[model samples]
Target: MQRLLHSSAPLWASLDKAMLGKLRKKTGYTFSNCKKALEVCGNDIAKAEEWLHEQAKALGWAKANKLEGRATAQGLVGVASDSSCVAMVEVNCETDFVARNKTFRSLVERVAAACLNHGKTLPQDNLTKSFLSADQLKTVPCGKEGGPLADHVALAIGSVGENLSLRRCALLQAPPRSAVHLSGYTHPAENSLGVGPVLCGRYGALVAFKATLDSAPKTQILGRQLCQHIVGMCPERIGDPEKDSPNPDTDSESVLIFQEFLLDVNQTVGNVLEEHDASILDFVRFECGEAC
Candidate 1:
């Protein structure tokens, strides 16, 4: 064999910029991967790029499968909404540290936004859904390029060195022309430093209700109070959680309406609402790592 002259020299020196640029734009692959493909196929752009696509799928599957068994107990609940629409999403990771990471936090926020924009809640969807599989989440696009949400989560897994998953999602909306208004509350996030904003939370609650009043502030306060109550109680039904009530025999305070209001224990939530003529139309509550 002839002596290999300057093997350290660039293997892709003959690969022109125009050809490389085409592959990069087509596959959205990084420069290193594009160059490697060019070198692997001896600068034959077409054949090299095809192989790269095949490798990407295989790599993604392999990477995603590796973390399937890892437990995801630490995460955050993100909520995004307006008066008529609300979306709440819980994304779980392996560690609290990663849960607090900006990328991870951003992933949660984007997922919530995607949930809001995706459309109305399906009739079949109910409280306490399962973890969002990679395929399930991949359908929701996010970020500047609008890549699949699953792709962003995958990146988090790869970069954070932990298994991260979309635990569940809830979407609630009031039909057009309805008197309903939606609101959300996310308990403050706490790091080693201290507590963060209220909406940056480990747990999140969303509530929507119809208001008959012309003065909006009172209804808004009632909406927020309901959301706050949901965060504290997390009841399955307006009446649920039949275990260990303080006076189980006489009263099941577990029922949402019957439960004592957080702000003033003297008044039941139902009584407070009755006094204001405001009713709870819909509610969703999510606490990180807690199952339904």
Candidate 2:
């Protein structure tokens, strides 16, 4: 019976992959989930779709066995920070509507906070083999629950009825002696979430700098401005444009020190920093739905 439905047998076969995909998207259901629904209903499109909502109500998890193939091209970046540490995470979903869900937004916030509390990423001595964000740090605990962060993610998936992914996570910290400003900014969603707190957004950024005595005020201002600049310009660094570089594998788009300044296009970020004697120690940027 199952083979007849899934296979191309004329007895049950009803549509090609294209039509199946269209139905899946229209129903906001995973491919296989939609397929099974279609099969069980004898390839009746409307009946199969009506069955999905019923299944959702009676089910606790969807796409558990098929989430990997789901396209995670929509999501928001989450940011969390404290006096000493900062964290950012890109939590992806299957659609913009899911990204706007309150539960999903809260999940992004909690995961970011988890990353911030997870402690700093390992030192640079072995930088060759490490993930930059909290998603890679397995021991980090979810802020709302006592279990590992991944568990919270799974719980969110069950409730949201979509695939959730922790694409990348990163934590940034300042040196012990100096008080660093860990600034984070989240761009508001298209529609306001209506009071409480905004946990997720279309874009997010984290920029940190070491405070110099007598230069505290200027550096702090610079940090805030840098974050704003990142949100607007999306530069690779505070340096000059690279024209002759032969290494196509190298990435400098997110390097704050190498990119041009948003405030004054004439001056590069590196030039401004040198003039002011301030240094950007570290930074991180995440835009929802960009390549991992």
* Highest TM-score against the true fold, candidate: 1
* Candidate 2 lDDT, 179-245, residue by residue in tens: 5566666676333243223246788878876545376566667766777668766865444335432
Error of 2 at 45 (Å): 43
Per-residue C-alpha lDDT of model 1 across residues 91-183, encoded as one tens digit per residue:
888899988887678667778777666634434233222234435666776634466777667655655667888777777766655677778
- Candidate with top lDDT is 1
Whole-model alpha-carbon lDDT for candidate 2: 0.64
What is the Cα-based lDDT of residue 228 in candidate 2? 68
Clashes of 1: 1
Give me the overall lDDT of model 1: 0.69
